[model samples]
Target: MNQTAPATLRSRLWWPSAAALTIAAAALGATLLLPRLFSDPVGVDPYVLRLTGVAIALAFVALVWSRFATVRPILLAVAAMTAAFSVFAGGPQWIENISGSRFDFNTQVLFASAAEALLTAVVAVLAVRTSPSTLRPLLRLRRFGPTALIATIVGVAVFVAVVMLLPATLLGREGIAPVALARDLPLQGPASVLQSFAQELQFRGLILGALDRVAPPWAANLGQAAFFGLAHIAVVYQGPGAAFVPVTIVLGFVLGWVTQRTGSLWPAIVIHAVADIAVTVGVIPGLYGY
Candidate 1:
């Protein structure tokens, strides 16, 4: 009876899990592949150069589709995730519009990152309010112990070490300015931290949390990581940084594993923040993030 029951459960779940994974892959393709194929790709709005329309459509499907009811929360979470992400990507435009002038680069990062985190928070809370109780355990914000602490220390050290050890040529840096970083770190540091937190909460906390409940652990981790990695393809769309996408995929998988192992979100957030800070400080893009 036990063996038969397990088989039956897998039979019921296989299709919905596969469908959710397909949605993630489509989201990635839309962001990474379609843009380069078309010169002037349309967007949900002036801000979201991509993804929101498809996200909303998927959300509608999740609302109506009774077939994939087993993984409905995961679908909704992904859909809401892309919608919120669009809001984040468009944050700079709205901020500039509201302020009537481009603020200092660090200041811009500060505000935009904060706004993104805020909007994602609202989306996350709402998802929780509506989702099944099973979803609650996956968004582990409370766990912090010896294991999490040690993981964070090791993770951060690795990030700093790799960036510092890499040659300037490989890092794509022209020069380093200690004075400029000293001036900017005060603001940029927090900005990067907030930005990382926003991303971790969205990809790891909200989306991964939703998936972890309904899917196998490894499958859940990969789904979220693939989406996270593909989202960064915009960075390489115009540049020769296409190789960077695979690196991000590996990093995403590692962070997902860390989150699962430690049962805490802090380790992932801090590690991600270290990477963000490295990018900001690595090249010293003078005055603003140019």
Candidate 2:
């Protein structure tokens, strides 16, 4: 019995260690290989590249460890690695610079975002299926009582108001023609709504729920929020600035909290879709009026 216990313990330790090392090596390889394969050498920042490599390696280690320990570390690592990747690679802004056309840029953003959302959904579904614990369904209309409905309405109103007022307040920008905006709404509204659903499914539904397995609710909320914020840096701002990161982080936090409180992603998804659609239709104008 003594020998059996030691052997089993050693086996337990060995598997996780091996998985960690393998993941780390793969991360390193991806970090080094991705830029060479997809990016122009002259524009790539060596410092950012090396930092990204390190961050990805650490994230891999954390992810592996999450199976045996608290998932907070993995969530933190994910946020860091996501931020690094957003700034260094996998951002549409860089592709825009290379392509040099608005049509190409928008197309790239659409396709890339869609592809990512799909992949994330697949992975998340698989993870949930394989996990020992049962997960709350992504949508639970029975739980969406009058209280949840009221909360959703309030959240959506607040988000829309903030988006509409931001240009005049913080950005000091003027409004565009309501007519022009109205004309584009038919197309923009549907696209934005779809994108928002995909985002909520991937970020709040999958990533946050996964972290919840081994972390405090608050930690899982904040970790996913940070990553969501980081993911927006490239999409939202023309250049690196202080405001964009904090804004998205705060927004993400609110969405994540709402998702947790309601025990469903529906409320958050509705708010996200409404906010994004508002922005797209010029209820929020560009910074400095473009």
Candidate 3:
């Protein structure tokens, strides 16, 4: 009877799990491949683009159809769409093209804010349509006590230290300008908060929770961290070297860990926001400015 029950459960879960993985792979592939095929020298035909769009629309409908039945497929769709938009819409090349007067801060914030808003809306809709009960734990703040707050503070401090130390240790210099940082703090601080909130919502709340349905908790945590890290490739075009990738991946791991441990996304959001604010304020007197 025990063996039969186990086998029965696997049979019930197998198809949904397979469907989730298939949709995720398809969405990711379309996001990456479609843009290349449509851009520059390899420009795809308009008819091809239209057909691709139709296909994606149909896929989206299928995802929605399954959302109330299972969370993983919709979760995969949302995560892939978020990453794709972040890369193709406001990526470094797009930023460079649109940047005119306030190239550094304002342009980046505007684009990032728009992308984050869109992703947040999508996640919100999915949460409402799918299973609010599944997401309640991620949204609840009962676990966000003194312990979590202290951990967030410590995490932000470590992040600041790393940002300060990396440039000197790896590149032989430090970037710091107190006066300029102070002057820009008014703008950068709120922008940092918005950016952090958006990321935490998508990654910790949506992606992590979704992955949990399909895999073991630890595997889900690591998988989301990897996705978060890869999404930062756009940063390479903005500046910094390949090292940024690993650093962000590690950061993602830490943030994901805290989110899972706390049973809430608030701690991770606070840590991320504070870390960005510290980076903007030149907290450690470093050469690698935010």
* Best model number under lDDT: 1
lDDT of 3 by residue, 177-210 (tens): 5566676776667777867777777677666655
**Clash pairs, model 1 backbone:** none
TM-score, prediction 2: 0.60
Kindly report which residue pairs in candidate 3 clash with one another.
Answer: 174-287, 175-286, 175-287
Ranking of all predicted structures according to TM-score, beginning with the best and ending with the worst? 1, 3, 2
Q: Could you list the CA RMSD of all candidates, in the order they appear?
A: 4.1, 8.9, 6.6
Candidate 3 residue runs with Cα over 4 Å from true position: 1-26, 33-59, 71-122, 132-137, 140-143, 167-176, 234-239, 278-290
lDDT tens readout by residue for model 1, 38-136: 664542334244565666666667657755555555665665556656666666667778886758656776777787677767766766766545434
Ten consecutive residues with minimal summed lDDT in candidate 2? 1-10
Enumerate clash totals for all models, in the order shown. Answer: 0, 0, 3
lDDT of each: 0.70, 0.56, 0.57
lDDT of 1: 0.70
Candidate 2 lDDT at 231 equals 52
Say which prediction, candidate 2 or candidate 3, comes out ahead on TM-score: 3
